[model samples]
Target: MKFAHDVIRKPVITERSMEGIADNKYVFEVAPNAGKIEIKKAVEEIFGVKVAKVNTIKLPGKWKRMGVYRGKRPDIKKAVVTLTADSKKIEIFENMM
Candidate 1:
C-alpha cells in the first residue's frame, strides 16, 4: 500500500496541462509504479477533488548519442485527472490566471 503522497510525485505544469485546468482536469507526474486506480484515489484524497476519470501516458526513454557515446533519457509517467462536474476547483490553480 503506497501512501497518497508517494503515489503522486508532483503536478505537471505545461501549456497543455494548464489548458486542462479550465475543463476541471489536472495533470500530475505520478509514480511509475502507480496504476490508474491508485492515481485516482491518491489525487482524490490529496486534492480533495472527486476524480471522474484518470488517463495515463507512459513516455519511453529516448536514446541519444554524443561524440560516439550513447545515453538514454529517463522514462516518465503522467496522469491526467478529470474532476467531477460539481466538484470545486482546485485551489492551487485558482489564481493561476
Candidate 2:
C-alpha cells in the first residue's frame, strides 16, 4: 500500500468543495493512477475518519493551442469522500472561512 501522503496530494479548496463540507463530504485531489480504494484508505489514514463511500472522477485533459503550437493539459483524478455519520469530522474544514 502506498503511504497516505503519496495517495492524497491535497484537499481541493474550491467553492464546490466548500459547499460539501456541510454534508460531511470532502473533496481531494489524488494521484492520477489512484483508485477509489486507495483514496479511501488514504483519507482514513490521514483524517482518521471512517469513509462511508468514495466517488472518483477522472477529468479529461484539455487541449490548448497557442501560436500554431498545441498542447494538452495533464489529466486529473479527484475523489469525493463521504464519511460515516459516526465518524469524527476533519478539523481543517472547520477553520476554513
Candidate 3:
C-alpha cells in the first residue's frame, strides 16, 4: 500500500485551482497510477477532512522542440477533490488565499 504522501504528490496552485477553494474543492497533482479511491483516502488522511467526491484527469504529454531536438513533457494526473459541506477548509490553502 502506498503512503498518503506518496499518493498525493503536490497541490496544484494555478489560478483555476485556487478559485475552487471557495467551493470546498481543491486540485492536486497526484501519482500517475493512483485512482479515485486512493486519492480520496489520501486527502482525508492528510487533511483530516471528509471527501465527498474525487474527479481525476489524465493529461497526455505534449511535444516540444528546440532548434534541432525534440522532447515531450511528462504526462500528469490531476485530481479535483471536493470536501463534505460541513468540512473545514484546508489550512495550507487558507494562508495562500
Q: Which candidate is the best by lDDT?
A: 3
lDDT of each: 0.90, 0.90, 0.95
Two-way TM-score contest, 2 vs 3, winner? 3
Q: What is the TM-score of each candidate against the true structure?
A: 0.90, 0.91, 0.95
Candidate 2 local lDDT, 1-97, one digit each (tens): 6898999998899899999988899999899988888889889888888999999989999999998999999999999999999998898888884
Clashes of each: 0, 0, 0
Task: Tell me model 1's lDDT, rounded to 2 decimals.
Answer: 0.90
> What's the best-to-worst order under TM-score?
3, 2, 1
Instruction: Write down the lDDT that model 2 would get.
Output: 0.90
lDDT of 3 by residue, 1-97 (tens): 8999999999999889999998999999999999999999999999999999999999999999998999999999999999999998899899888
In terms of lDDT, model 3 sits at 0.95
Model 2 lDDT, residue 56, Cα = 92
- Name the candidate, 1 or 2, with the larger TM-score value: 2
Ranking of candidates on lDDT, top first: 3, 2, 1
**Candidate 1: tens digits of C-alpha lDDT, residues 1-97:** 7999999998887788889888998988889989999999998898888999999999998999999999999999999999999998988777775
Lowest summed lDDT window (length 10), candidate 2:
88-97
